[model samples]
Target: MSRIDYSVWDHIEVSDDEDATHPNVNTASLFRWRHQARVERTEAFRKKGAELEEALAESKHELTRAHEKAGELAAGSSKARDDIERLKREEREWEEKVAAHRREEKKTPWNADTLCRGGFSKIAVINDVKTESVGEETETFMSFEKRYEKDVKRFAAMRSWDDSEEYLSDNPHLLCAETFNLLMMMCVDLEVLKKRESLEQTAHQAVVMRFISRLAKALKVDPRACFRRFFSKMKAADQRQLDTFADELECFKEEVRSAAKSPAWKAMDEAQRELEKEEERLEVFESLPEEMQRCFDRKDVRMLQEVIGRMEPAEARAHMKRCVKAGFWVPGAKVDGGDDDGGSDKEEDDA
Candidate 1:
């Protein structure tokens, strides 16, 4: 006969079931308070786990950089030797930190909510085509969109963490850097077009996507594997972290707005930068005094000089500054005093 196992019931936290309290005390309210406190404690523990993971990731990144730098130095150099020793010591320290954290995590008792959380043994197998690794695929924006656009839209439509989590769990391949980048661009595009409601929903999706990315980076795992953990954390009454995500969304929207109002804030190629610069110059030209604008419009250097000659010194200086900025005035034309052709040539060149 197989042995009956009863240890599975260990550490079961039943907030509603306990010995009766004093008659004057409200049992229901007390149970609610206890549940709240337990949730808060769990949330705090989750936050600490995230923080520790981040620190470990940073430490590993730093150690990798140190090794790369050390490899570039002379093998026998004193500095290289010192760095090697230092790196070894730092590596041991971080390993110890990680080991201690793992121990602590193991010591934490499972409550009713977490008792049946996902584990390797709990994963179900499905007979489906194998999904290609992202690293193996060259996914351009168009290809990524063509493949996952419908899934992304469906995800963006979800407003609840539980729903979003379930959707992503069904479609794990959508959890990737490419999807995050595309979603961010969509949010920015929506903001640019003043689609407030759509932008809000898209921005929400973008923030959640970013959280999954961060979780993956912290744990050194694929983002698709991190989505469940991220959603689980969000569902654990972690209101502060949710508020943080909301703040991130607001900041991202603000950045998009700022970039739309001023293209210089966004990175661009040389041609795009030149185009933006010309557009900016045209705006300045429009703001110039009417006489100055007309002079430039007519390509009349003589008229422009006459207009400047009539203005107060301070006003003329300001107008001249705008003219130079607008590519209408070249300070050093490299022309003979009486050569109109040379001046006109310089004006054409500047324009």
Candidate 2:
């Protein structure tokens, strides 16, 4: 009636019950499904290929960066190696220079003998001069007694009588035997005079006169002449004290003589010889070369010796001008032109 769409069902197949014993399946339909499956597989393969391509590009970039970093590290390593080599060379050079300096130092000898030519004690001559100034007044006898007491106490404290025996055995002057003997004799005479009342005045005068005579003799003067001169200076009250002082003076003179002959004298002589030798050696060494001579111009004696040992004599002589300028040595050891005889030869040739 209204043109129902029965024509739309034209391709639709209806199978009768009697004829549907086996259902028909088309090969084309199977081929169409297989084609779709194949298309899906191809699309998946394309996606995987695209992903692999992107990953490969990123890997290539990373590899390029790694190579750049490796090159930079290699360059730094090379620079470090170069610096190490340079430092090693500098170290080697420094060591060589130090060794050379040490070798130079070894050639020279240290001479300390120069300092000892004279005894270390300074000797000065003191002239007696009159002074208006007066010191605090003290009795001469009291002062002498105090000094003698102090000397005795010091000697006792030192136990010099016992401990100094070894030194005395080696050197008789160290014991001051002559002074001790003089002191003992004077003491015995005084004791005897004190006990004899009847002969006291005569014995006192005789003892005093004899003591004064002995002192003058020890001093290398005439006893009678010296006593007359000495008595002229004294007031009557001081005469007795002066006589006593004369006795002490005699003993003191002997002590001084004995001390002078001690073993200290021998040691001093040895020291003087050593000093002379040192001065001689240094003077000879200084005469060597001009440059070496210049080194001696300085006050550093040890360094001059070292430099001298290393230098040639001719070279050192050439540098003598510097030594002359510095005043370490006198100049003109080397002459200009030739020897003194050469002048005469030159004059004969000119004539």
Candidate 3:
């Protein structure tokens, strides 16, 4: 019986010997470890991909915002350029308007000579009047009226005329053939009252009358005025005379100025002589007593001294006594001492 069970024991012992030689191992465990490592690698790759996608989306959003901001800046720049262009255009237009106005102003008729002398051909019609008898006269009258109206309009425009209606209603004649020339002249001379640098009143009056006389003759109109225009032209003839006189006066003044520099003009010579004499007289007067001051100032002292020195002793004594009586010389002064002997002799004779 023991031999029969020994075969089973030999088989078991053979299996154990084979297991010891191979070493015990499990296929399922090896497979499971390799699968776990592969899963971890896949999960890490997926997470990295998600993070890259998020970063790409954020970059795209920032790019879009930058584009919109750039568009707004371009629009703002365009608007600023348009506004500047408009302002420039407006400035140019204003400058053009200013230039045009200045040109228009320059074209206006302001030549004093042309206005006064009726040089302009432009005319306006007055009411129908006697053409045959007073054609020339009427033209002149109308011209004057137009000139006066122009002046009144100018004054009104300047806001200088207070009584416009009254001035217009009065219809003051600037020149009337019927009135005395002197009256018109007087009106012209009134201009001098308003000015500090006018001709002398008497001289100006004379000049004005002379001018009016000629104007009346030339125009064959009465020299009359409802209102005076200050800067009217003088008659050509009278103006010529005045010009000649003024030229002569200017020449004379020039000569005087030249001669004054040279120390030779007669007036200056006379003035210098007078000044010297006055100085000499003042010196003498200053030395005299207050009571005798007037007499010394009045007399030529050098001449008086010579006269007294040349006089006979008796006459000189008499003169000294008179001077003493007049309070010009004090009785006990040196001037009175010269005649003392004569006075004593006279007193002795009287005794």
Candidate 4:
């Protein structure tokens, strides 16, 4: 058998927002047309089969007429016998054609789902409801997504990418959207944290992302499946290749750190500023109870607000004050409907 070429899916880009729509395309109409087309195709098959059955029924009528004609002829006449046999042969042929049509109807139906499943494969059977090496016992989709998100974020903050990879190797279930997105965000955060010396960290991030993407493309499986493959390949690589990666990583870091105006620094050495902000956020985060801390872990402002809402007025005020002071809530971060707009009311409130 020839190998499949899966290159078409290689460069497909996934939108950051799942429900985002293109203004130029009428997605509703497209879906409607597709559904209509599928219905018509299905009906077409049934209609053809119905027509075949009708013809077969007509042939049976002809056979009955021929038998009646034979009965009216002389009992020993060869002509009457030949007529009956000819009608019987025609009836048999019609019956065979109808049977063949029924078999044709049983062939697999084709559509988007078939294409996605790579055609004619069994409808996926979610066996045991549990993975072999990683993850908790099967839970609802929401619960699993949340659990993986938390774990992935926590793992992404590890000191080294290798450490992060190792964690993922152990907890393979985290090698998914939650993990990949958090990994990307982790790269951004590290870049933000390291104004000047982000080269090595960013390099590592890029390498990890590339490894996952390329392996996924090669294997024609989801990126999650290729996590182990990537690590194995890296582990088996030659020492010279390893040394080159390490030396280049360090050199890139040194080069970035040497830059006069790195993005992290914002044109002036703000090492203390970033550190102070991180310390403040952590302080605020640590002060919260576990339930409240969950909102922070998820970066969910509204949930945090709701948690605060249920508190006594004084308690809410105190929590808000601490959050404000710690820089957990940024001065100009956008809220629902709009952004801060840099107004004096916020300053008054802060003051």
lDDT for model 2, on a 0 to 1 scale? Answer: 0.43
lDDT of 4 by residue, 1-351 (tens): 769965555443233453455888787886677678777887898767755664565456556756766776778789878867887898798889889988775554445533365455457767666553433422444475566766755664556647867787777776554444445444445555664344344446544654466456544577766576556545778563365455545544444444424565453346646876888788778887776788778987667766765776666667666766775656567766785534422432544
Where does candidate 1 stray beyond 4 Å?
Answer: 1-99, 102-139, 262-351
Off by over 4 Å in 2: 1-237, 269-351
What would the per-residue lDDT of candidate 3 be over residues 190-255, giving only the tens digit for each residue?
Answer: 332333133223233333333444444433444443122112222233563356435433433343
Evaluated at residue 287, the lDDT of candidate 1 is: 87
**Which pairs clash inside model 1?**
none
* Order of quality (lDDT): 1, 4, 2, 3
> Superposing all C-alpha atoms, what RMSD in Å does each candidate have to the true structure?
15.6, 54.3, 48.0, 31.8
Error of 1 at 32 (Å): 38
| CA displacement after TM-score superposition, residue 6 of candidate 4 (Å) | 29
**Cα shift from native, residue 171, model 2 (Å):** 36
- Number of the predicted model whose TM-score against the real structure is largest: 1
Candidate 4 whole-model C-alpha lDDT, 0 to 1: 0.60
Query: Residues 113-224, candidate 1, lDDT per residue (tens digit)?
Result: 6777656756657888777776556456658888898899888889998899888889888888778777876776676678999988988888898878877877877887
User: What lDDT score is found at residue 31 in candidate 4?
Assistant: 66
